[model samples]
Target: MAPKRMPKVYLVRHGETEWTINGRHTGTTDLPLTANGEAIMLKLGDKAAGPGKLIDPTLIGTVMVSPRLRAKRTFELIFSHSPVKPPMTIDERVREWTYGDYEGFYKHEAVAARKAKGLPSGEGGWDIWVDGCEGGESAQEMTDRADEVVRTVRDAHRKWYEDPERKEGDKGGDVLIVSHGHFSRCFLARWLALPLPAGQLFVLDPGGVCVGQYYHDLGKTALGAMNLGLI
Candidate 1:
């Protein structure tokens, strides 16, 4: 059996907002939480506090969030009852992608624009990932940023792993991450050392959480459990 101890990452995507429901690329816009979103997060908090085979509330060490208002609000409301509050930090590298000209534009709108512009269709052209809306991020640009964030966090947490006395027989240290949708998917791909394009494989929704477990003996590998939606 695997040891009771291991390092785990609990990922929480912020709750739904009007933009999310509309299929708009929300990137960097600061949208407030919907009432439905708030309720889902409250339930998620209750779930976190309950006992589980692989998760324990007390073992969580840090709560990191994107600086955006949506993520911060979700974290604040969800952990309101925790007596042993961990240190919280905002990381820009983990923030939502800057959508640039694409901000707030709907999917069909962009598709129509692509057809009108007669942009190239493959490898380096107008597909949703590679093509920016005139002046936004190509999927590749976002991937690079996600990779940098994952490495930086992993490196900084080496101390958690280095300490021999820190619960050698439990789920060990954990981090609670609250972030946006698109970049969160990208983060998952990078964490698993998958090709950046592999991010396209994951579909994230509002009020959903994904868990990633890292097995040290197995090397820096990421085991992802995805799309645990609060709804």
Candidate 2:
């Protein structure tokens, strides 16, 4: 059999939470989705299915998500009407970065605190990707976690895609990863085997979906799209 083609991974940042709307670092806070967040999630399902870009609503594969209520609810709202229920799992590896000291603080306030101490902007002040929080993991640590999650997902999909006995339509794998904004960006970078600092290059908004594709023939990976289906 030919080498299996890995399926494209679709990552959706959970809908707007109170912290998200306020530009705060949420990271494992388990906040509920805002009213508008709910509305946008419903729209996302329709858009992904309506266009030929993603798997049809009836198609089945996997919908792994963070165990947090916000992430789980987003998955439920999006796939509520699908005829075929895909396998769902909660992978802690996909959870948001642990914000530690910065948790619950507004973005501006967080930046101000870093600046007060003469720290840099964008990513606290742990030195680029380093976690500036007093007690939380650094950016490099988050990158390590994200890398593990991507590796696990990639290995699983590779196995599924290589199952020769599977039918043609069943050959493809679709992963709906529901996670928080900052960590999602890190995951995207890891998916493309990019440097941890590269995560800052992408912005992941609530209810945004980023697609990454691995081109086997070309021996490379590409960010198919970013911040798609935003409302």
Candidate 3:
């Protein structure tokens, strides 16, 4: 019962945008959700928020949202049912991995472009997690950013977990994040103390939800759920 009061982190991926639909690397470009994106987000709001849902509005202590319009819009949709707005941080740290020169290009296109430019596309070909975008962030940079996200989330959770009033019926709130697909995966990998490439091990769809909770105590974190579709 004491463990149940331990706060969890709710990871949410933004809904689809035009680039998302076309299989393009949408990084740094602020795009709004599509009509279908909005519809799906609305459906997700119904299933994800409120009582007995994966994200209980009243139980959200902090929200870390990407500065991108798509991610910000996703938060609005998810918590549309909330009685009061939760505290949020429009953190650039959770923003998508900027594609740089590969921006707006598909994975294959980026690979082909890299090959044409006489760049090392890796033996297996252009792996963003390994080689990274030509002019954008490197794997190490993303790792550091992901580390920051983990720390901030842990701090938010600590408040509820260590509260003196928690021994009673005080159920602490959870930390929420509304970010892009790749970034969220990376963040989760860092949360689990795994390498950045381990992010490729899991896939998170647009409007999907992932949950992480403390195991044993607040010191050890475990994946509660991943790639869960609300809509």
Candidate 4:
């Protein structure tokens, strides 16, 4: 068997929604993309997933999408123009972080509500990475789910790497994941074997695309690119 080659994973956040534009904690809320969001995603798809683009559609082997309408729609728009359409599977693990009581509340409002209820806030305020939303999933729980996703994808990649039919320099082993903002960040953190709180430092804007890949060794993963937008 040939030595395992590092594989790249593309993390894509869904297009803009009303709550996303308004900076609200949009968790478990199924919101559709706005007109502008759809337009932006169309352009992004052409630039990022088109031939000779950052994400070559032909090279994509696996596509995992969140079950949310916004995420599903974004994935559809992104590959609508591509010549190759990879099979897509809905993974509940890729869904957005559940905000529970903080749902529909803006950032400031969530912080204030937590304070009013005598809940402890991090030094930087009520960050979901630390405080996690009340009545929702804790950081540990989210980490567990995200880790499961990582394992699933990695297991598939390992099979591809071990396949004798695969040739060198073929990046077709890449995996594409379409999901929400916060959860995407968490997914990236877990991909690098970092703590969930470390996700707080990463930011994935609407319609943004980030790439993660193994470094010198297949066991070590690193961020290849992030916050890429359509030029």
**CA lDDT of each prediction against the hidden true structure:** 0.71, 0.73, 0.85, 0.85
By lDDT rank, best first, the candidates go 4, 3, 2, 1
**Model 4, 114: alpha-carbon shift in Å?**
1.8
- Residue lDDT tens for model 4, 1-231: 556557778899999999888888887999999999999999888777866777777677788899999999998898888887777789888999998999989888988898899889777568788777789988888999899989988887777776778565565788889998889988989998999988877999899999988777667778998889745
Model 4: how far residue 30 lies from native, Å: 0.7
Cα RMSD for candidates in order: 3.3, 3.2, 2.0, 2.1
lDDT of 1 at 87: 55
**TM-score, each model?**
0.84, 0.84, 0.92, 0.92
lDDT of 2: 0.73
lDDT of 1: 0.71
Question: Which digits, one per residue and each the tens of the lDDT, describe model 3 over residues 136-212?
Answer: 99889899999998998898888777666654445446888899988988998999999999999888998899998
Q: Which stretches of candidate 4 lie over 4 Å from their true place?
A: 1-5, 122-124, 167-171
Backbone clash pairs for candidate 3 read none
Clashes of each: 1, 2, 0, 0
TM-score of 2: 0.84
Query: RMSD in Å for candidate 3, one decimal?
Result: 2.0
Better of 1 and 3 by TM-score: 3
- Clashes counted in candidate 2 amount to 2
